[model samples]
Target: MIFYHFGKYILLLKSVFRRPEKASIYKREIFKEMVDIGLGSLGIISIISIFIGAVTTVQTAFQLVSDLIPKSIIGSITRDSTILELSPTICSLVLAGKIGSSIASQIGTMRVTEQIDALEIMGINAPGYLILPKLLAGVMMIPLLVIIAIFLSITGGYFAGVASGAVTAAEYIQGLTTDFIPFTVTVAMVKAVIFAFIITTVSSYQGFYTDGGALEVGQSSTKAVVISCISILVADYIIAQLLL
Candidate 1:
């Protein structure tokens, strides 16, 4: 059963990367789904980004002052962490939770209902049609989401710094700029793209081959989230190592 399910997943992945000779009619559809996943999921990403930045700033300020560390570098620390790790890795996990589960359940349900099979009968490349567009969308939108995450997080951190009396708003902003690196954004963008692809592709695969009935759909959804979460963490470490 495991291999039966995984075999399809591997094949779908191969199909996704297949050359022009292997490409099918489903690529555009996958792109549209990607856009939907990205645009639709923006709210959660925005809310989380703001709060995470605020909390990190608050905590960093408290610790720096409380621990008698250099106060001026607080903003730099916050900025670096947000751009390098927090924004990309954390946001990917969020997407895995919000969008990944949705992809799994929706597709899994469609599978159980025989819609995927019908598409195949109609000569559609079911995997390409269902999975590719979503995968592409995820790959595309994740970087945009990460960029937003960075901006919101940094802004929130600045506010928190002033509100908490750890640093003046201007000082906090100044500290952030001193340590700014353009490549950090590129690093984050790369990570977001990879993470997006991982979550979307894995979730879609789980959904694509879901079996049994509604129970199986539920199981697939749970598995999709679990696997995606784990994959995100693993991929983060791997990608970070590769990039850094």
Candidate 2:
């Protein structure tokens, strides 16, 4: 069954990547999806990022109880942690729940309502028309969101470290600025893109193959979120191992 679903998912991806019937329409749809996936997700990302960073900073400071250790190390730990793992991974997981479920439900509804059938009747490339824009948008916007999340998380760490008496402002700033690796950012971006692709394509696959009616649609949505999250975690570990 797993092999069957995997084969079907691969076939669906091929269909999704096929040439679109109209470039202009696809472009318009792409922009709409970008806004929906990016802008719509900003609020929750912001909240989650800030708190995570703050907590990481506090916890890291708590653990480094040695008087011999510099307080600035807290900032370095928080910065690296956020960039390498927290921002991209956590934010992607949250988005898997938000955007994945929405995509599944939307496509599942269309499938059940015969809208997808109607598209076929009209000679449209239904998968290309329905899923391609989402794929493109996810590829583009998710990285941008990760960037924002990284920045916000660091900022939050700074404030929390200072306010909580965990680290001084000057020490935190020095730590954040010092010994930073450019490659970490590259790895994060790579993870962001891969996670984005996983979320959009997996959700769309679940939705496109949805069977039955309302109850089934709900099931598909739930499955999409669960699968997307699992895929994100697996991809995260693989990327980390390969890159770092």
Candidate 3:
């Protein structure tokens, strides 16, 4: 089953990357997908990121019982955690449910409704036309969202620390700026791009081959989310091992 699905995914990718028939049409589609996937997801991403950061700050502060460890370490811990793991991995997991499921359902609906067939009948490269724009948009927009998420999460951590008296504002600010490694940001971007591709391509692949009606479309969406989440985690581990 693994090999079968893997082969199918590879074939689907080949079709999805084929040359576009119309550059202008493809550009418009890419922009539309960018709005749909990126802007549409911002609210939920922001909300989740803030809470994740706040909770991480509280939890990290609680664990540090030793006086030797400075309270400023809370800020540094939050910053590293948010940028390295929480923002990229957690946000991508959430997006697997949000964006992955949406992509699956939307394309699955079109497949079931024969819209994809119609495109093929018109001699269009249906996979390229339907999936390429989404792929491009996902790759481009998800990293941008991750960057925003990283900022919001760090800000949330700062607010949480100050409000709860877990750490002073001065200490938190000091921790944030001290010994910051630029490579962590690079690692986060790598993870974001990989996660974005997994979410878009896996979901699109599920939807593209969907064979039934509305009920099956829903199943595909759920499956897409599940698979994308797993893929994201696996990729996360691999990227971390290689990069860090």
Candidate 4:
């Protein structure tokens, strides 16, 4: 069954990447999806990122309970943690719940209602028309969101550290500026793109293959989120191993 589903998923991806019948229409759809996936997600992502960074800083400070360690190291630790793991992985997980479920439900509903059948009857490339826009949008916007997350997280750490009297402002600033590896950002972006692809495509696959009615739609949505999350975690580990 897993092999069957995997084969189907691969075929669906091939369909999704097929050339569109109307480039202009696909472009419009891509833009709309970008707005929905990126701008619509900003508030939750921002709030979560800030708090995650703050907690990381506080926890790291709590752990390094020795006079031998410099307080500035807290900033460095927070910065690297946020960039390497917290921002990309956690935000992607959050988005797997939000955007992944939405995609699955939307597509599942369409499938159950025979909207996809109508598209096929009309000679439209249904997968390309529906999923391609989302794929492109995810690829474009998710990395940008991760970049924003990285900045906000570091800022949050700074505020939390200073406010908690855990580190001085000068120390935090110096730590943030010191010994920063530019390649980490590259790794983060790679992870973000892969995670975004997993979220969008896995959800779409669940939705596209959905059977039955409303209850089934909800089931498909749930499955989409679950599968997307699992895929994201697996991909995260693989990317870390290969890239880092």
**Residue 52, candidate 4: how far off, in angstroms?**
0.7
Q: By lDDT, who's the top model here? A: 2
Write model 1 residue lDDT over 47-88, tens digit each, in one string: 998888999888887777454555667788889899989999
lDDT of each: 0.83, 0.96, 0.96, 0.95
Q: Which scores greater on lDDT, model 3 or model 4? A: 3
lDDT (10s digit) by residue, model 4, range 130-221: 99999899989989999999999999999999999989899999888889999999999999999999999999999999999999999999
Candidate 2 lDDT over residue span 1-244, tens digit each: 9999999999999999898999999999999999999999999999999999999999999999899999989989999999999999999999999999999999999999999999999999999999999999999999999999999999999999999999999999999999999999999999999999999999999999998999999999999999999999999999999999
TM-score of 4: 0.99
Per-residue error for 104 in candidate 3, Å, reads 0.3
Off by over 4 Å in 3: none
- Judging by TM-score, tell me the better candidate of 1 and 2: 2
Model 1 — which ten-residue stretch has the worst lDDT? 18-27
User: Using lDDT as the measure, what is the rank order of every candidate, best first?
Assistant: 2, 3, 4, 1
Give candidate 1 misplaced runs (Cα > 4 Å). 1-8, 18-31, 66-69
Q: Once model 2 is optimally superposed onto the true structure by TM-score, how far is the C-alpha of residue 154 displaced, in angstroms? A: 0.3
RMSD of 2: 0.5
lDDT of 1: 0.83
The alpha-carbon lDDT assigned to residue 159 of candidate 1 equals: 83
Stretches of candidate 2 off by over 4 Å are: none
Q: What is the alpha-carbon RMSD of candidate 1 to the true structure? A: 2.6
